[model samples]
Target: MRLKDKVIIVTGSTTGIGKAIAKAAISEGAKVLVHGLEEDLGLQAIQELGEENTVLHIEDISAAGCPEKLVELAIKTWGKIDAIVNNAAWVVNSDIGTTGKAFLGKVLEVNSIAPFLLIKSALPYLSVSKGVVLNIGSVNAWSGEPNLLAYSISKGALMTMTRNLGDVLPRTHSVRVNQINPGWVLTERERQHKKQDGLSENWYEEIPAMYAPSGRILWPSEIAAAAVYWLADESGPISGQVVDLEQHPLMGRNAPKDPSTIHGKP
Candidate 1:
């Protein structure tokens, strides 16, 4: 019951990591606003998380007035907002040639700008309640795969914003902000995405040692578990921090140098 009676808003909660976080928050005695664009999936989330502890919000994060509406819904439903998990994002692939200004703009709008707006709209209430904001980022923010150029740029911007606000908000507004960057999580959508990319259905079972030091990547629930600490008061005044939730160190780590261990490309 670390988050007892807290009211949280988790965008993209209809599926994947966002849904897992909503489920975890409710289990800890919190009421949550589960948001997603898919009406059917939002209904499913509402059903699974229970109507008593959760409310569903269906909208495109990039659309105008969406952030304010989300804040309005949360406040109107529970009369208060304790935390906001900015987990909604556009995860798409595009290299240099494919990533034009519009592509980059759209990615930034959904992944970074929308989160900023949500925080701004909820800041007044959050400051009054001494609430927290958790941003779900990605390990790819530290430069990224060639195909994820625009997404990486957007996440990098978000990481910067989180660090900037993490310091600014806590002191000026009395609200804390922090971010978690998860690496290679095994979500349902990820399984389907990989299969579409020509990987076998059981590709996760045979990950390369370099990619999965523990013979597996990570799970949505595991990331959700990490998110709770930031949302709870137990985190104290800690702010302006970005934690990497990967199996191993992402920087300056040399591979085994064994070509035999590397079988084929992903």
Candidate 2:
């Protein structure tokens, strides 16, 4: 077990990539803190993973004092925190020009600021365990996501935060910080987008071949594998790096060369 006896906190664990990461962590013999705003889903995750291995905490990370409380709970329950995956973020789908000020603020608060705050709160506990921090970024950060303007901006901020945190963490405390930027992952929210746009869920199926050169969308499990790896001591030398899960074109500047090699070197 890579994470034997370790305790991890994964926010937004009720569903999507967050759910997959939480389950994977549990499988690797780690005690997982399942966090989210949904009480029922949190309980469901607890039940699915078994009460002995998982604990459910219902709280909005965007809320003030919430990050500290969460870290406190993890310490109180398990006596230590080995890793933290900042997987909580969301947007209602609006471009910069169209998005309201409140919407933009909300996006940054939940997607960007909250992650930073959580890291700060968990630093002490993480330092004791020489733990790592895995923040969830997105392909939208670099791509021209006209529809997700605020979200993109927030993710962009997250990348910068990941780097800055990594740089300072090692010098100050032994904690390491990094991020995983996943490409067009088909989460429930992403599926809703396809349904709303009146398109096939597999419309982007050829994207990996046509655009990504990988030939398919990134599965939640694949991303979860990377997260689990990063949580272990093996990822110590990989701090401050932004692991892009997007299938970058295998050809010229931005063109696909081969679909089978989408997971190849960038």
Candidate 3:
């Protein structure tokens, strides 16, 4: 019950890591608002987590006014927000030449701009609560992943925002801003990419060792654990830092997933 009596709004929680985070938060006694494009899935989350503990908000984060609406709903329902997790994202696997302006714009808008708006709207409530903002970033924020150029740039911008907001927000308001850079997650997207690349069914098995040196693709559960740790009160002294959850590329290549070789140590 680390988040006992807390209120949190997680964007795009119908599936994937977002859903996992919402589920975890609820399990720890935080009333959660589940948001995403899938109305059915969002409702399902409310049902799964129990209607009393979870609320569903079906919307597209990419839309213009959705972010503010989300914050408003959280306040109306819970009286305050203890945390806001900006986990919604749009991704494109294309080089700059292969990606058109429209695609790039969409990527940046959803990945960077939308999160900014969400934070801006939530800042007032967060300031009063002295809340935390947990941004879900990616390893691509640092990696030069050619195929995911726009996606990388957008995430990189988010990482910068986390740092920028951390400095400015605390001085004027009490809210703390930080980010988590999830490693190569074995999510639906990764599975699809494996199939697209004609990789073996065991592609994920090799991924942890091959790409991350951890010999394990990060599961949604693991990421949720990290998020919860950050959101909880113990992390009050921690802010303005991006926790890189992936293994160091060079060290990871040395002995993938050899628990001893992997660096999960804080």
Candidate 4:
């Protein structure tokens, strides 16, 4: 087991990519603190992962002091901390015209500020264990689709934090930080989001090839697999990387040409 005896805290892990990461860590013999906003979901995760291997933490991360509380619980229960996966996020649609100060602030609080607080609170323990921090970011962090203005800004800030911490922390504390920016993952949350936008129930089957180059979007498990590498000792002292997990090249690539243009349609 690559992560044998490690103690990991994964926030927003009741569902989607976060849930998958918690399961992966536990599968590798790590004990996990599975966090989520809903008590029922957290309890479900604890049941699924087994009580001996997991602890359920229910909290709204945006609330003050919640990040520190989570870190304290992990230490109190397990005696030490080995890793943290900052996976919780609050995503909402907001174009320039629709975005307001309060809306933007809320997004930043949950998606950006909470992660920083958690890292700060966990720093002392991380230093002692020489642990790792894996931040779950998004491809939308680059510039984002116009509709996701606030969300994009928050994620972009998180990417910056990941790089900044990754560089400085390892030098003195031996703690490593890294981030992964995933593109077009298909989770239950995504399904609902698309459905709200008027997509049909079977929308996944109808995604254009231009958007889903591999005939499908990414799965939560795929992201989990990559996370294990960064979280485990096998990775060997690497940090300060922002990996874009996407099929298309994220930079210096032309947009896909229209098929009709090739056929010379008038």
Query: TM-score: which candidate is best?
Result: 1
Off by over 4 Å in 4: 259-266
Worst 10 residues of 4 by lDDT: 257-266
TM of each candidate vs. truth: 0.97, 0.90, 0.90, 0.95
Model 1, 1-266: lDDT tens per residue?
99999999999999999999999999999999999999999998999999999888899998999999999999999999999999999889899999999889999999999999999999999988999999999999999999999999999999999999998998899999999999999998999989999999899998887887677789999999999999998999999999999988899887666523634443
What is candidate 2's lDDT per residue for 1-266, written digit by digit as tens?
A: 98889999999998889999998998989999889999998888788888999878898889989999889889989999999999998855787578898888999999999999999899889989988999999877775467888889899999999999898897788888999989878677777887788877666654444454546677788899989999887665677889788766322555546544444533
Identify the runs in model 2 with alpha carbons over 4 angstroms from their true place: 201-208, 212-214, 250-266
Candidate lDDT (C-alpha), each: 0.93, 0.85, 0.85, 0.92
Off by over 4 Å in 3: 212-214, 249-266
Q: Over the stretch 1-266, how does candidate 3's per-residue lDDT look in tens digits?
A: 99999999999898888989998998998999889998888888788878898778888898979998998888889899989999999866888688888888899889999999999999888988899999999988986488889899899999999999988887788888899998778776668877888998777664433455556777988899999999999887677889888756523355534443324431
Cα deviation at 205, candidate 3, in Å, is 2.8
Number of backbone collisions per candidate, in order? Answer: 0, 3, 4, 0
C-alpha lDDT of candidate 2 relative to the true structure: 0.85
lDDT rank, highest first?
Answer: 1, 4, 3, 2
What are the per-residue Cα lDDT tens digits for candidate 4 across 1-266? Answer: 98999999999999999999999999999999999999998898899998999888899999988999899999989999999999999978999999999989999999999999999999999999999999999999999998999999999999999999999999988999999999999988999999999989988876665676556789999999999999999889899999998877877865447522322322
Better of 2 and 4 by lDDT: 4
Best by lDDT: 1
C-alpha displacement of 84 in model 1, angstroms? 0.3
